[model samples]
Target: MKVCELERSLFESFPKVDAESWDHVGLSVGDPDSTVGRVLVALDATADMVRRAHDGGANVLLAHHPVYIAAPDAFVPRSGSHPQAAAAVFEAARLGVS
Candidate 1:
């Protein structure tokens, strides 16, 4: 299935409306139209998790917690500020893993 279809299924099971106003509950990265080969579920979108997902042939990485609570001004690896999020997002994008 496509990423959008999977996202729709997830939202149907856990409606976005049920989440808090400040919660980031939807897709944080990747193309909605991209085909999903596999899914890697985790608690956080850490760099290690992204690597595991990519290595395992998963096109999407479904994480309970988002990479960042708020969008960072820049996604720079080892930026000192929000390093984990930055690295995760950067690696995911680089490797074509959501």
Candidate 2:
């Protein structure tokens, strides 16, 4: 399934509007046009989790909590801030996971 299609499906069941105003829900990383054959769901998208998802052959990752949370710089590993989360984000992007 395509990433956009998967987003739509997830919203149908758990609408983004349903999420708390402070919550960031939906695809965190990856291209919308990308295709996914398998998905990995987790509460947090930690560096370890990202590696596991890639190693396990999961093309998409459905996370309950937002990794950025209004902090865009947190996803940059080279920034030396939020390294673990950044590692996860970078790894996920490298693996083409959403």
Candidate 3:
């Protein structure tokens, strides 16, 4: 399945409207058209998780927690309050993992 297709399926089952108003619940990185070779579901999107996904040949990391609650002013890896999230987002994009 493609990233966008998986996203659609997920949202269909757990509608985005059901989430808290302030919750960030959607794809935070990667191209929607990218094909999903494998999926690694995890509790969070950390830099380590991104590496593991790449090592395990999973182009898609279906993490439960969103990378950020709100969009960052800039994506400066390891230089923010949420360093892990910043690193994960940067790494995911660099490694071409969705």
RMSD to truth, every model: 1.2, 2.0, 1.6
What would the per-residue lDDT of candidate 2 be over residues 17-97, giving only the tens digit for each residue?
888898867777889998887888898887678778888998888887776667455565435556566777888887777
lDDT by residue (1-98, candidate 1, tens digit) is 99999999999999999988888778887889999999999999998999999999998999998788787777767556666888888888888986
The ten-residue window of minimal lDDT in model 3 covers 74-83
For candidate 3, what is the total of clashing residue pairs? Answer: 0
The TM-scores, one per candidate, come to 0.92, 0.85, 0.90
- Winning candidate number (TM-score): 1
Put down candidate 3 lDDT per residue, 44-84, tens digits, no spaces.
98888988999999999998888778776666566647556
lDDT of 1: 0.86
Give the worst 10-residue stretch by lDDT in candidate 2: 71-80
* Residue ranges of candidate 2 with Cα displaced over 4 Å: 78-80
